[model samples]
Target: MGDGPVTRETTKSAADDIRVDQWAGGVRRITITRPTLRNAYRSQTAVEIAAAIEQFTADDADQVLVITGAGGAFCAGGDLTSSYESTHADAVQLGHGVVIREGMHRVMRALALCDKPVIAMISGPAVAGGLALALACDLRIGDDTARLGDTSGMVGLLPDEGGAWLFPRAMGTDHALRMLWGCELYDAQQALELGLLTQVVPAAELESAVLALATRITRTAPLTTRVVKRMVRNAMSQSLHASLIEAEYAVAAINDTADVREGIAAFLDKRTPRFVGR
Candidate 1:
């Protein structure tokens, strides 16, 4: 989006939760805004976020997605009041699982399925479902002002919003259960130590640092970035032998991309490479 369209879809309340901004170098940032609720999402908010992610999935013009929130908080979790609202005419006839499966669960799936990179910019509390949202991202950049953990159990709830699986995978079952059961909230430093955050910075530098990283990613070969992301995710559940075989084929295909040729040419010419996502 360095020299492309710039758009801002801003609206108050859950009617429109998505505020999409185009930064330089094909970086598309989506800011979730629900200031009255500490950015806590309802059914409509999750739907909008999921829709934005699905749009990003196909839009080649966008190379990266930065997900953050307006105000101080990243997200507080799902809005409990609306979590079980069946009075709405559009409400599903099915039970509780369907509500979540269609709401935040869809948002989780969208983030997981997105080919482009998703980075979380955590400013304040990111607990319960909010933690799941952050963990779903490819990377999370936080500041000392932030708090991270699972507090769903305190309210007699569970990590139904992707945390059930994402938490364990990120910090192992023991740590995940400890946090979930204990309803613990950790500071930014503790979150970093627990592998919940990629990096932490001063509150003043949080935005700049995350944007800088996103920009750096945009400068890399797009094909390489996508392929590497896929390969690594696949390797997590695959055997070493299977992973190696996949890498063999992946390298062969990557070497043939036009971006690879451009990279080689740039190296030979002693110049910065310009990748076109070919």
Candidate 2:
């Protein structure tokens, strides 16, 4: 961020104890760093992940976020050794209490709530909560070597972390139930066939593909993109008339932005608009 000294001092910490690397051209890559543990998510890691995403939203220099894992695994799921040892099923009522499941919810909410698009680039295994994380992203591009599954049933736990909500919405109810109940792993091609992945690129081309998508997204007017995103989301819960009203308001707002002016001028001149993300 090229913010002045005051803004620099006030900026939130991008990542804490997580391997978060920010590129110069508005792309931030967040890697779960604990490869020895296969990137199992801990409570602190979840909080840090949320904080990192919040940082990305506040920083005008960054427009896209790509989340992946280190050491060839996206995530092995929740840190089972830690959670299982601590949580007692008998202590909690049937969904009446907090259930101490806030970590997963917070992580999922952070990604889903972000205004900008998120892309998950997967190359290796994603099981249980790990698969849920990838599913939470707006788009997923995987390599041939990737694997995805919900292994919670195998370990005697119901799928958590918005998996139950997101999976049914992504894949049909029957397919989601089958994967969760059967606890089977699907390879990249199978995942693609099942509509879990947007595209399957070679392992070597994964990074480039993700970057290209980010570049394409950032080339548009930033405010227009944000409004269009909201309109699409609103359509899910509201009536078409309400959605159209929102879209009209958004278009009016976008027309007032400097990027819209540049876009109009560029179109008349038969040239590409160099958007400044205004």
Say which candidate scores most in TM-score: 1
Query: lDDT per prediction?
Result: 0.86, 0.78
| Residue pairs clashing, model 1 | 1-26
> What is the model-wide C-alpha lDDT for candidate 1?
0.86
Candidate 1 weakest ten by summed lDDT: 1-10
Error of 1 at 151 (Å): 0.8
Candidate 2 pairs with clashing backbones:
none
TM per candidate comes to 0.92, 0.88
In model 1, the runs with Cα more than 4 Å from the true position are: 1-14, 85-94
Write one digit per residue (lDDT tens) for candidate 1, span 136-206.
99999999999999888877877889899999998889999999989999999999999999999999888
Which digits, one per residue and each the tens of the lDDT, describe model 2 over residues 143-190? 888999888887677776788888888788999999998998999999
Kindly state the number of residue pairs that clash in model 1.
1
